[model samples]
Target: MFKHAHFKAHTALFLQATGLTGGPGAAPLFSGLDLQIPTGLTAVTGDEGTGKTSLLRLLSGDLSAHSGTRPATDALWLNLALPEHDEATPEQVWSALQQQCPRWSTELQQDVTEALSLQVHLGKKLFMLSTGSRRKVGLVALLASGATLTCLDQPYVSLDQGSIQVVRGFLNDMADHPTRAWLVADYEADPDLDWSSCITLG
Candidate 1:
């Protein structure tokens, strides 16, 4: 398991949302949705039209909910596929994240980079890499961020079989962590993972 000495103290409740709705004008995705997120591996599963990504954004404080108590936490949600990062290389992104994330782990970053076979792509720009490779870059940063709460949207999507296993292994190792939570939003929870909580939307 990845080791970080300073663990941020938290209540049993890592995150709480009450009566949460998507947006102002949009139809309510789930009305009066109450959730208590604890520290551990959490799987948010739902159909295509469901608000998985929106819920993650709300948790990460990237977007405001229509109406609810969705308090923000020290969260990390990296969407590196944006146009602004197209010209940036993985090495550049890693350097930037290291400066931004106070608890960043260089050891974890190096280990994950090797496990995912991403060393070769670090020098290439984001646009020059394939979809899976780009996602791996984001995964590397996310895993090493050591944020209080880490939100991963469709983490396994577009990943190669080997890389997928690497990601899964890391999450499995984090399943019983004392602090820090990882919220993975996907279509369905992987049966192999020991999820502490599972939220189903749709």
Candidate 2:
């Protein structure tokens, strides 16, 4: 069993930005933004093209902000939609992820796999699965990672209602832990989520 640490090492993420602009000559997507996301579930909501994706990218260090500082995180996981490898099956990719991710949890992996009903798709190649199945595989990876801060972009993209319910249940359960944080940016709000905080961009 994973012990929930009562004391948070630091805030989940903090960004002090004068603005988040695109490339040179491009207008700022969002300006004068500052946030201190705490250790719990946070929902980033806003209209499209409002820098929601940019904000998440900056937090995960996948994209740099024009004038902002993203604090260091001890363990961070960013949701990635992997490309289809002709020969790679879901099982192979999952095995590879387990080997590469330092915070990977076997117990959590099993739990998510079962919760999402992913066993049927495990042996199928990434290209063979439906969109929802592929997304579920990625969800399993993100949930099982056990990172201190996990950033998920559009987690409910292709999920069915049943699978979405399972995800919501898992998130509700994970919220009990005092140390880990989940940052989700999506266009639509999940009515069932009990968010620690909700931020709107633009």
Candidate 3:
């Protein structure tokens, strides 16, 4: 868990998207969409084909918009269940991320690692870990990255109940953070969370 005093204080919009529209085909998943994302927790909820992941990708600059404006910003979108480094051990991945993320927090990483019971698997290659464990690895990176805008796609997919609770507890602590934004895309918003905003798609 993060101490409230560890967070920096800043008042600024994390991201803004206007007239956004893009998808796999000629028919876009969503059109003329606008969003004003601010610091704190936000939820993107929708059914299977409702473009939840697509919106996150567009916002994170992982996918180009068909017609809209989303200014560049420091952001991260890591698919928790399937990271790219299949051959690297969690320890290696953590070390690489620490070098890459200018604001990475070693304390948060250690806390999350222990909270998720990930210490035992750090030396094993990612491919050797179970799906839930792999997701836990991604969770550690995501939380510790300390990016201004952190996007999580279906974060709870393969997590066990205890791990799920841990993730939720972390998010709960982050809900009122003053300088960072966390956008969670899932089927429905967790009723227990105090979301700063909730965007529901078709």
Q: Count the backbone clashes (under 3 Å) in each candidate.
A: 0, 0, 0
| lDDT per residue (tens digit) for residues 80-157 in model 2 | 345645457767776877776688888988888888898887888877888888888788888887776777888888
Deviation of model 1 at 113, angstroms: 0.6
Each model's TM-score? 0.88, 0.80, 0.87
RMSD of 2: 6.5
Report how far residue 147 has shifted in candidate 1, in Å. Answer: 0.9
Off by over 4 Å in 1: 1-11, 24-30
Sorting all predicted structures by lDDT, with the top scorer first, yields 1, 3, 2
Comparison by TM-score, 1 against 2, better one: 1
RMSD of each: 6.2, 6.5, 6.0
Cα lDDT, all candidates: 0.83, 0.69, 0.82
What TM-score should be assigned to candidate 1? 0.88
| Better TM-score candidate (2, 3) | 3
Error at 40, model 3, angstroms: 0.9
Question: Arrange candidates by TM-score, highest first: which order?
Answer: 1, 3, 2
RMSD of 3: 6.0
